[model samples]
Target: MHARPEAWILSIGNELLVGRIVNTNASWLARRLTFMGFNVSRIITIPDSIDDIVLEVRRGLGKVRVIITTGGLGPTHDDVTLEGIAKALNKNLILNSEAYEMIKEFYNRRNMPLTRERIKMAYMPEGARALRNPIGSAPGCIIEVDSTIIVSLPGVPREMEAIFEEEVKSILEIIAPKISIVECSLKTRGIPESSIAPFLEHIAKSHSNVYVKSHPLGFELDKPILELRLLVSATSEDTAKGIARSIMEDIIREVLKLGGSTSSEYCV
Candidate 1:
């Protein structure tokens, strides 16, 4: 979409739905996907129910270029992400040889047997390739259906990050659009967000390629501090940064005209 590949992050876990744990996986994946030139359009959280997973996974398939799912991939009965994905794609869950070996080796080193629960991590949807997890028992997986790629990672933060870095990054790089994004955050004080709402909207409308948003850091009734983030995507890093810098300068000038003070402008 918009000349950039689109992606979605689907986080599945009962704990997440119940607020027992934070959904940091979605935010981490979102940042990675955006930095890789994919427009992360949605970050969805669903319960670890097979029906819910099937619904969301099927919704993402063929609609976005990439879909990344995290969580519910452990050895417990509640860990049924793969099963739900298989059902979503109308495929059978089969023991993946590569994944099985990875799991077996992980247990062998620990002098542990391949119990039924442990072996459960080896099953995946048909035709999916197992990604080696450098930090945990469960190996991740990637599968392509039509033009869409679906990647599933373990819920553990360290395990998910490791697999994505070691295995999934290469695959995504192959399909990611040749685009660069530059993001800059500027801090503004002595002006409330409401006072700058119109200006922000005008800036966004003026630059169709640039994304503008404001994060308020203080109460609106008082002299509020606002963190303004400007993001622009271009074919090269220099071009993207230049556009973002120009936009930031314009915003800063406008804020100064409105009796606001600006500081701490940095790009990433």
Candidate 2:
């Protein structure tokens, strides 16, 4: 049996693309998903443009099992993620009364008038399931279409993190099979990248399920250290972690066997 490749993150907002905002949402989502043992296969950023969003959605749907999008989901003219998702799936945005009432209450609580524009935040792609925004005005949505699960969350990091943690987490746990990609690393001193290439390659071929890479720091500054990472992708966290742990143990054993000093981190 084999594990399915799962979960891609899509970030939406013109601010992100134009560099007005650094995309903390993607990293936050990835870290959370990784902790939950979901394979964070890919992460991409796009503008608020519908065409761009739809294109990325279609492309991601083909490759990843679950698609989680953040940003462009608010009660404003520029918030077009809902329509983009609907178009990508060939659906329409329809008014969701539950969401409508929620949005209404949001305004009422703040002592603000519910303008027709703000109330429109209740509209969702037809057949989309609403994921309540416990902290924000816009309700996120989860739609199951063509075997792919799409979850949309607010772009604001706090709100996005909240909804993902509170709402989408349990739902995905129910629908998604257990899977994980785990990795552990070793920091080697007195070793250069060129010197470790063959060893890295040897380890990689021996474990087809694992990947190895070396990163060098401070090469131009006359002092450089090499980092070797052993990445393992498996169907479950235990399997992935087990493999990673085994490899790390083997590397430690080898270094100790050779009377060479190794460290968990490179020191200055």
Candidate 3:
């Protein structure tokens, strides 16, 4: 396995487009992938249209090494993800035998009708790898387009989470082969991006390999909080941990001196 350049997450669903859904899938998966040491380039939300889906997939292929798409893999008319992905890659949509049988068994177990529409969940693009979904009927697929690995998962958060854990996570672990890519995150209270920009600029310039990102989640007890991400690249877990720890200590001291109190030295 070789190194992963990065991942571009494209979350689909008309609900997400019209603001019916908040797109928690992309945010959740992005943070998970980043913490696992695979870089996430961008998170985009698009409507359930073939032209738009293919366009975004084609565009993301050029910029990122991987693409993970969520939504539209259900048994409804709007469940057009399979069709769009096939159209994008000029691939054929065929029913996966295993997935078909799995869905059949599910309906049989429930004593429900084996309708053709319900079986639609088993269809996938030709030459694509199916990602098993133990929790739902919609089986996901991982395909390669222009040398980019594109993962299509169900829209349901629990189902998406299961397929990714079963399919994508292990693949990334194999590709990266980290003896230990240790990371440390610091959660600080009452600090805005403006106040930390200059300090982060210096830190970033000094440590090019160490990545830092701030996520503002309104803090506990009515105080605003920012989570500082400190990622280090090293061959060993201990070495990576040491590098992250050192960088974290420096940032904590600097932020404290700047009148921003830290809620944690290491956030998990």
Query: How well is each residue in 170-245 modelled by candidate 3, as lDDT tens digits?
Result: 8776654453455677888867767887888788788756767787877678767888877676666677777788
Q: Name the TM-score of candidate 2.
A: 0.86
Of 1 and 2, the candidate ahead on TM-score is: 1
Q: What C-alpha lDDT, on a 0 to 100 scale, does residue 61 get in candidate 2? A: 70
Give all candidates' CA lDDT scores: 0.91, 0.79, 0.81
Task: Mark the regions of model 1 whose C-alpha exceeds 4 Å error after superposition.
Answer: none
Best-performing candidate as measured by TM-score: 1
lDDT of 1 by residue, 14-54 (tens): 89888999888888999999888899989999988999999
My TM-score estimates for the predictions, one after another, are 0.97, 0.86, 0.86
Off by over 4 Å in 3: 1-4, 177-181, 187-196, 213-227
Q: Given candidate 2, what's the lDDT at residue 102?
A: 82
**Per-model C-alpha RMSD:** 1.4, 3.5, 3.2
lDDT of 3 at 150: 84
On a 0 to 1 TM-score scale, where does candidate 3 land against the true structure? Answer: 0.86
Badly placed stretches (over 4 Å) of model 2 are: 35-37, 179-181, 219-221, 233-242, 253-261, 265-268
Least accurate 10 contiguous residues by lDDT in model 1: 216-225
